[model samples]
Target: MFLRTVTTAATLLAMGVTASLAQDPIEERQQIMKDNGQAMRVLVPMARGQADYDAEAALAAFVSIRDDAARFGELFPEGTETGGDTRAKPEIWTDREGFDAAVAAFVEDAEAAVAAAPADLDAFRPVFGAMAENCGDCHEVYQVPEN
Candidate 1:
């Protein structure tokens, strides 16, 4: 009987841990944005000619952004307009159609960058610049300014 009780307690503890690991939408989206930022860190210096152009690194960054873009819209579910220290503007929920279109444009740009597979600095510049602009435009409309 004692062994069974202990086993049950362990199972309950494991379940609680799993539940805690499940992130709410705000947390999930924040993580996705953070990941995109990391990818940008990899690409931006090369774009600026501050770092050597690396085709492999550039492609990886593009892929990371593309993958994140694919799921980014889904992370902004109906009730996620607030909380979790979100910088998401209410415009995301209020202007859902526009927000979605912006996300679509970003996804398209990311995919194009990956497909273009820029092999040199000259080739990468245009593709990277376009994607960067997309990010800025979306943030202008959809995100609150950081304090």
Candidate 2:
């Protein structure tokens, strides 16, 4: 009975440790980006005029971006550069200042997009385009191309 209890306790402890380590920085940041993508999807059809414009939805999407932007820097801590199928380019660490600036610019633009939330599909195009431009700029410089 004592041996059985110890075995179960060890198994439970190992599971706890595994769960804690499961979400490393790379996975955490990727999940954040995935969430951002989800928000963008909410705005895509409206921006293209395929769906009726919804100001509340547009603003909420922008807010999601803004919120994620604030946590951008924390997701790229040192030593997390090469692991777990990360697509982060070495340039992110090599040009840390530039990468940080890009993140800051994204945060600023995200906020601007939120504040300039469009009331109509026509108005949303430019605003969404500008925010997307920031994302593209960072990805071009910092993200590794997928094979």
Candidate 3:
């Protein structure tokens, strides 16, 4: 139906409909990481993000990260775009299944990290560190730090 109308096709293409379907999962994963990273960076700096500072808002942020981290696993579907500038190393593509398992681990750990966050600064520190460690672990094995 969409292709039947030349005008519609043009509109869809302009709206970013042409190439995404053809891209592999890795590409999607990398884009997701970059996007999520942007969001995390922004939220982490806010005083309301810390439990000691604003327990409610900080918990909200933690919950968001906790949930998003799990969903993020879908973005890195192995060999889809691992060779690109993504922090993911090429080895990830070589062992696609393992890569996915790693993502699962991160998701689980991230949730724990978020859950561990307490309303105190001291408590929030370790919880947040856990979250960062999950990310760092992946980067160490499958990703390259951005220059």
Candidate 4:
């Protein structure tokens, strides 16, 4: 009886995970959008801080932003759920060509943003803000956070 109960519990857990994965792709995208936003929140402050001039801090923030952005792109094509967590806006799917262009633009902007980070810790106001703007444009149209 105990063995049966444990097996049932495990099966139920597996089903639950599958069910969650089947949830609207938009929901997953929303979560990713939120995560990206959170990461951005952490990064900008560190860069903007007076102490950000330190070599270590700037490098860390750049790496963090780049890594997070790369993870965000995972939801688009490379993910198991290509259709899942992809509140990429209906237009993106329908206007495939234009959408691809936008995504390319984002990648370029993000890469440039990270590259622009100075080795000696300089004022990254312009580049970082541009990076955020690139992300923001997509989120504005494609991502919606759940209430």
**Each prediction's whole-model lDDT (CA):** 0.83, 0.79, 0.59, 0.55
Highest lDDT model number: 1
Tens-digit per-residue lDDT, 1-147, candidate 1: 664465456445534643453478777677677768877898999998899998877887798789778888988888877778989999998899999999999999999999999999999999999999999999999999888
**TM-score of each prediction:** 0.84, 0.79, 0.60, 0.55
Q: Put down candidate 2 lDDT per residue, 76-113, tens digits, no spaces.
A: 98998998899999999999999999999899888888
Instruction: Arrange candidates, best lDDT first.
Output: 1, 2, 3, 4
Which 10-residue window in model 2 sums to the lowest lDDT? 10-19
Worst 10 residues of 4 by lDDT: 73-82
| Candidate 3: clashing pairs of residues | 26-80, 26-81, 29-75, 87-143, 89-142
- Comparing 2 and 3 on TM-score, the stronger one: 2
lDDT of 3 at 27: 55
Q: Which prediction has more favorable lDDT, 1 or 2?
A: 1
- Residue-level lDDT for 138 in candidate 3: 74
Backbone clash tally (model 3): 5
Best by TM-score: 1
Off by over 4 Å in 3: 1-27, 42-52, 82-85
lDDT for model 3 comes to 0.59
